[model samples]
Target: MNTPTFRNWQSVQSEVLRRIHAREWPPGELIPNEADLAIEFGCARSTVNRALRSLAESGLLDRRRKAGTRVAAQPVAKATIDIAVIRHEVEEHGAKYGYQLITRRIAVPPVSVSGTMKTRAQDKLLHVRALHLADDAAYAVEDRWINTAIVPDAAAEPFDVLSANEWLIEHAPYTHGDISFSAVQADQGDAEVLGVAPLSALFAIDRVTWDNAAAVTKVRLLFLPGYKLRTQL
Candidate 1:
């Protein structure tokens, strides 16, 4: 197996699949052992093991002890992500779609921000702040920081026509992202942006994306008071 350079397991898996499909690691080729992958990924051996095990169970690879793992001669599965457009999501609920770009800037990421991204202190980010509306009403305020080092073209885009969330779905292609959801009392800044009273309860969604070797973006979206998100598994 060829060693993958990605920092995250999800990205590693995606790259592994890509390489397999591209014949970089041809079918029946023994892949690099898990220890080598763990070192390359800068993660625990268990993490690499988990990703490889998943691939094996999906029939993309065949795993065996001592003999190690190899790409399956007949790969049996493929995965696809259905990225939904936020505008479509809102409109599906009978709400009109409106978007406003609040601010756009290129800045050195702050210490706190750098820590979250696992990036160096001097890294620059393409910062985008915007509001998403429903029927001309505030629906959400989004604060996003794009890692310019990972996706340099982000600095050249004109975001006035498309929200960062929408633009990223088209520009960035990653297998998965880390998402965290929480509820918090809106601060003055968040409240003003979302057109709600300070201290009002709101829902927050934070997401961080990664490619093989670097962090791609970090975003925090604050929903207006009374906005509810529902999903079924």
Candidate 2:
């Protein structure tokens, strides 16, 4: 059989998604290895790797180092937490969005934060705290630290009109990152900012984004009580 020429990784990804959706590759079925797919698609192994990686990240495939790749029997509903912008999130709910810049300063981050970002303890980072509102009500509070060395423009941007969260989405495009979700009781500071009672349970999301291998920023977002995060598989 003649191999089909794929223009790019996206083409390969689309074809893979199409097959999975059409059940040509059924759930729990082992898919061809990257070498085989590359040859079939007339593309390089790296191209196939990128396509598969994207699908795995989206919760469509399960990839293991030694076990190879397989379609997920029960695909997880992955949230778009990696690239979600606060402003867009609020506006998407049909609510009038508002932003407040609470604080901005250059300071040494905590030891834990420094360790997570892999920055030296002596390095000064740009710290920014802000609140996002929906229809004039408290929505979420953002505590963020930016690496000035990696994002010099962050220092000059006042973060008054636009939030650092939205700004970074526009300016700093990351290649890879990590995100975690948890529930926490609102502390004094979180309560005051989110207009919730102290010790009230709230949803928290911690994210760290990187440009290639260099850390760009780390942020913790605490949402008001009763906030719901939903995604479809």
Candidate 3:
């Protein structure tokens, strides 16, 4: 049989994925090292490395610095949610998007927020509150805190023409973050901003992102009733 040659990292990745799915490399089995994979695939070592790194990110393969890469005995299926531009998201749905900045201040946040953000209680953060509108009707209320120490440019931003949600995404790109989705009863502040009854059930997403080890921003977005989120595993 002619030796199979791969041209790019994606082709190598596809072949590796095929081997995994076909059980040619079974679960918990240590796969060949990158140098060996490179020789076998007729590609550069970096191509194999890139392919393996992609699989590792997706929880399919486990790679240790010194330890040989191995197939995950149990691969975790992850649903990735990309940070979205709300204006684009609303316009895609055929509604005119509007934004209103409700509050912008530099202040000490709550103790819980400080703890999660890894900032001292006395450390003042930039807090901005805004409302997103769809066809002039309330869509979501965004309450956010930005670490000016990490992103100094945010301190000068008024968040009037732009929302903090969209601003931080463009400026401070985070390496990783935590996110949670829940059905929350609207508090008075959020209810007033979203124009919903206080205590009405709302879909809420609380997220905290960091640029490397330094905290970047923490935000909570409470959507009006009937908000639907869809993601794939």
Estimate the TM-score of every prediction.
0.63, 0.70, 0.70
Candidate 1, residues 22-105: lDDT per residue as tens digits? 999999999999998788777788878878888887888999898999999887665443335668878988999999999999
Q: Which regions of candidate 2 are displaced past 4 Å?
A: 1-82
User: Cα miss at 45, model 2 (Å)?
Assistant: 22
**Each model's C-alpha lDDT?**
0.84, 0.92, 0.91
- Candidate 2: RMSD over Cα atoms? 6.6
Better of 2 and 3 by lDDT: 2
Q: 1 or 3: which has the higher TM-score?
A: 3
Provide the RMSD of all predictions against the true structure, rounded to 1 decimal.
13.9, 6.6, 4.2
Clashing pairs in 2: none
* Highest lDDT model number: 2
Winner of 1 and 2 under lDDT? 2
Please give the clash total of every predicted structure, in order.
4, 0, 0
TM-score of 1: 0.63
Considering summed lDDT, which 10 consecutive residues are worst modelled in model 3? Answer: 77-86
